[model samples]
Target chain A: MSVSVQREDFDVGLEYARFVAGRTDVGGVALFVGQVRAESGQVAAMTLEHYPGMTERQIDAIAAEARARWALDACRVIHRYGRLVPGDRIVLVMTAASHRQAALESCHFLIDWLKTKAPFWKYEESETGARWVEAKETDDQAAQRWRR
Target chain B: MKILYFAWLKTKTGLGEEDVPQLPAGVTNVGQLIDWLAGRGGGFAEAFANRGLVRAAVNQDYAQPDTPIRAGDEIAFFPPVTGGVG
Candidate 1:
């Protein structure tokens, strides 16, 4: 399990290579990358804020939970904080397993859980003004599906 | 106790963090602490007016309204998380 919260961007290919390096047991790898989007084409930039210690710890816990639920050989979560524009990478989730189902399911679980459970916030700058992004009810519902 | 605010709450409260040597006797739990903070009036009141919007963490961990708190604890208040996709 690996989890990182940084202000700097990451290279997805490099990260994936490092995750799978010399891991012969892993047969399947599932990866997801989240990027900043101009939902209405009005967003100029976005500022991501997070609680320092809490952000990393929460993500680690989420990754651990995903591991517990699936037969994952390895899991990686990298989330970026600070200012970013549309198309900038914001987060990444990668999971490796002996089978595709485990890898894919774990990757999905990590992303869904991180959306609602992590301690990060976003502020968007647009034409009208800057405003804090509100938590979407759809995200809550997305996370709720994982609860057993 | 150290009280911290983040995101919009920090903007609304006009403060990022504060050191409170001690918490009042009634501020035993997260909920009571929020009530006391709201009583402070001014920006605090406005930031805490809507309980539905506020989220709390005790010592960097997500906390519920009834979570126990103490003088040495580090408490944080902020809006719900809006993290990016996977």
Candidate 2:
């Protein structure tokens, strides 16, 4: 299990290779990458800020929950903070398991829970000015599905 | 106790973190601390003007409104999380 919150970008291929390397029990690998979108077309940049200590702790806890819920061989979560432009990668979630179902489901669970439970905030720079992004009710609803 | 702010809250308060030797009387929980912070006026009032918008954490963990607080505790306040798959 690994969780990293850093400003540096990561290579998907390298991470995936490292995750499954020497793990003969792994049969499936599920990976998800999130990138900054040009939502309004006017967004020039997006800055991500987080509570340093809390961000890592929360993400690690979430990963632990995923491991408990699924028989995952390995799980990796990488979230980048600092200024990013549209098309830049923002986050990555990868899970390896003995079966496809466990790998896929755990990957999904990690992303969903991280959405609302994590302490990161986003600020967007647009033509008008830079402003804090508002939390969407949709995100809350998405996270609610995991309660069961 | 240490109070920390993030994102816009930090910008508004002009402080990222501060050490409070003592919490005011009657401020024994996250909610009450917020109310007490508002009482400090100025940037604090503006930052916490909308209670629903502020989110709190106790010792780097997500904290509820009624979460108990005490001396030597590290408390953080910020806006709701906007992080998702992206």
Assess the local accuracy of residue A41 in candidate 2 as a C-alpha lDDT between 0 and 100. 96
In Å, candidate 1's interface RMSD is: 1.3
Question: Candidate 2: TM-score?
Answer: 0.97
Displacement of the residue A63 alpha carbon in candidate 1, Å = 0.8
- Alpha-carbon lDDT of model 2: 0.92
Model 1 Cα lDDT, one tens digit per residue, B1-86: 99999998999899999999998878899999999999999999999999999999999998999999999999999999999763
Which of the CAPRI classes, incorrect, acceptable, medium or high, describes model 2?
medium
Deviation from native of the Cα of residue B16 in model 1, angstroms: 0.5
lDDT of 2 by residue, B1-86 (tens): 99999988998888999999997898899999999988889999999999999999999998998999999999999999999355
A147 Cα displacement, candidate 1 (Å): 0.8
Candidate 1 CAPRI level: high
| C-alpha lDDT of all candidate models, in order | 0.93, 0.92
